[model samples]
Target: MTSRDTDATTDATTDAAAREHATATTAATGPAATAADAPVTISYEEIDGARIAVVSLNRPAKLNGLTMAMLRGLDDAAATLRRDRDLRGVIFAGAGNSFCAGLDFGSVLKKPMDIVKAFAPNPLAGDGANLFQRVCWEWRRLPAPVIAVVHGHCYGGGVQLALGADFRVTAADARWSVLEAKWGLIPDMSGARTLADHVGAEQARWLTMTGRELSGAEAVEVGLATETTESLDDAHSRARETLRELMGRSPDQLAATKSLFNHAWRSPRATFRAERFEQAKLLLSENAARARTAAMKKTPPNFVRRGTWAFGAKKK
Candidate 1:
């Protein structure tokens, strides 16, 4: 729920580290690392940054599918981010060929019924946050901005996961999809909440319900992605180039601007006030359960037409 502040050191050192790691941030090398010192399981990378802490989700075999273990790691990473000064941002990326494939197939299969169950009146519980939201929310909650570099397949939970980051740079050919419906699931990993944060509700539903495929290029159009690069190498380069722009800003000025924009989607204040209610309706609807259940069977789910609001209805 809380993260510690990182220690201060020569900006030159942190800058060099950030450049070297490419995907990692400069916060890792600071005294804030004390929080990260905890004994941990699972493979992860921590890069110290003067203004950011870069965290990498390491299980390439599953395409970085999140597991309970990975969740715990994320918790630790968030904890390490608790209050302190000096650090200005956080960055996240996945290890290996893919950014994240979403939740592992076995994890989803274990509680096939959860998707149909009514979401509690509150999605945020014990931690005052939900794991699904934490996937992207944790990154958003930081006092700083979170930058994500996505490549390869960014689908379902994976895309939702990236939704948490403030900015994202992806690969040109990366394959993306909402896909939860295809697997009899919903974008519980914070996708539902954050989907409209960038893209609007209608677009979000069409993607979630139908589970159509998307390319990295389309992602930019849909607002799920920021820009596309030819490869990971280029993606990182652009990230650094963007970072250079960030580095020029006064830390205080940048922080304030980020904070203002971070909560720009505040419920009462967000423009989707009307759609938010409808979305909540669907989240708890029986129709959602039936639709999700069918998709899990690998059945082809019906979706609304791209420009039309019709779901499964005959072409007009």
Candidate 2:
């Protein structure tokens, strides 16, 4: 064949392959496979010389509804943050008006096999967490503290996501709900586990069964939120301020405390044992010495970079 003919054929082949790949992706993920549906975004900001990670859900037009891609994005973000020893804190937020309106069932239900894959446990990690659960649970496992800033609609999986954080600061007027009941479903996204840590069994049952919406103030009253602010900006500011305060302390202690509460809270013996173990390590660390020297000299503590310490076995 002529060189021009060969070039033309190659171009056509590439075009056909592109079309086939696009068609396959669309079929697998449904119509939600658009540029606008670009799941989650992660960025780092150096605040007061401490590196803080911010994870934002990018689907604002649909109220940041959760999709399979978004779930994987969240999991990936958590994994990335876990590896960063310099990370002091993390903030989870929504890009637009709402935090998240729960799972995008219409988009996800299109692929039954994807749902099955998401529901299956991770064989290698031995954590007993499926993809849906890991997206939330991984936040609890990170050495750095996580705070969820809730503003608009936070329902179903969104609520679970916030619960996974060490703290949740919400806009006073934001709507919060355990909305799984509304869809004739239960929260399978680790909400069942985290919710118990915050509230009483009766209260947990009421919220899960009724799926009643609560204002930010009400959420705080019922133990769903750490605190509420008058506006979205205020909520974020409060979260940042809290992180700044946390930055003043030793990162190792903060990590140890999180692990203690998350893993050993329900067992007094375990809590005591963990406290002693973690305290022994912290007391002998350089950061603790810096804290002591700074306190004695009445100067700010200049701590060394944090160490990644694994305290407990992975929990579901």
Candidate 3:
């Protein structure tokens, strides 16, 4: 064959392979989204020498409603963040006015089998969380803190998504609700864990059963939010301020702190044991010694980078 003919054949083969791969991936997950059509977008930057990941729900005309594509995009972003040890924090936001309205019931309701597939349990995941659950749960277990900047509507699945963050800063006029009850369902995502922890069991049950709307201020009062601002810019400012304060701490301590507090929600025996175990692990680290020296000298400590540390079976 002529060289030109050979190149044309090769190009055709590559195009066919790409199309096949895209089709398979879409079938396994859901719809495909290109940069122009994506429901979610993730970006990162270094702020004050700290790496911060930013995740945005980009379907604004529909108020950033949750779709399989958006969920998968978010899950993929969370997975990426989990592996980045240099990441100091994450800011979860939505493009345009709202963070997220809720599930796009219009699309999801038409795909019963797809819903089942999304929830298929995984044996390797100790908690039995499927794809739907991991999108939220992963944020909770992320090595760095996640701060959600909320504005406008945050209902149902949106509420669950925000709950996954360590701190949620919402605009005072933003709407918040536990809306599944209104749709004849329940908050089946990891919202249950976050709600039970943030608000006590009684309040969690009441809110879930009622599905009533709460203003951002009321959300803070009810323990569903960390703080409320006058506007979206204010929310971002608050998150940035919090991130700056957090950047001063050692990553090991931050991870250990999150783990220790998370353990607090468990049995007393487990909590105590985890406390001792985490302390022991941290105590043996060279970073801990550096921290001590820095404290004595009143200077910033140059501890070991986060991903470099390994502690027994805990090193995932």
Tens-digit lDDT track of model 3 for 134-178: 888888889899999888878888888899899999999889888
Off by over 4 Å in 3: 1-35, 307-316
lDDT of each: 0.59, 0.76, 0.75
Residues 132-191 of candidate 1: C-alpha lDDT, one tens digit per residue = 456466766665556788887677767887888879888888877887777666777667
Worst 10-residue lDDT window for candidate 3 reads 1-10
TM-score, model 1 to reference: 0.65
lDDT value for model 2: 0.76
Better of 2 and 3 by TM-score: 3
**Candidate 2 regions with alpha-carbon error over 4 angstroms:** 1-37, 308-316
Residue-level lDDT tens digits of model 2 in 229-266 = 99887887788899999999988888878877776545
Each prediction's RMSD over C-alphas, in Å, is 18.3, 12.7, 11.8
TM-score of each: 0.65, 0.83, 0.85
By summed lDDT, the worst window of 10 consecutive residues in model 1 runs over: 1-10
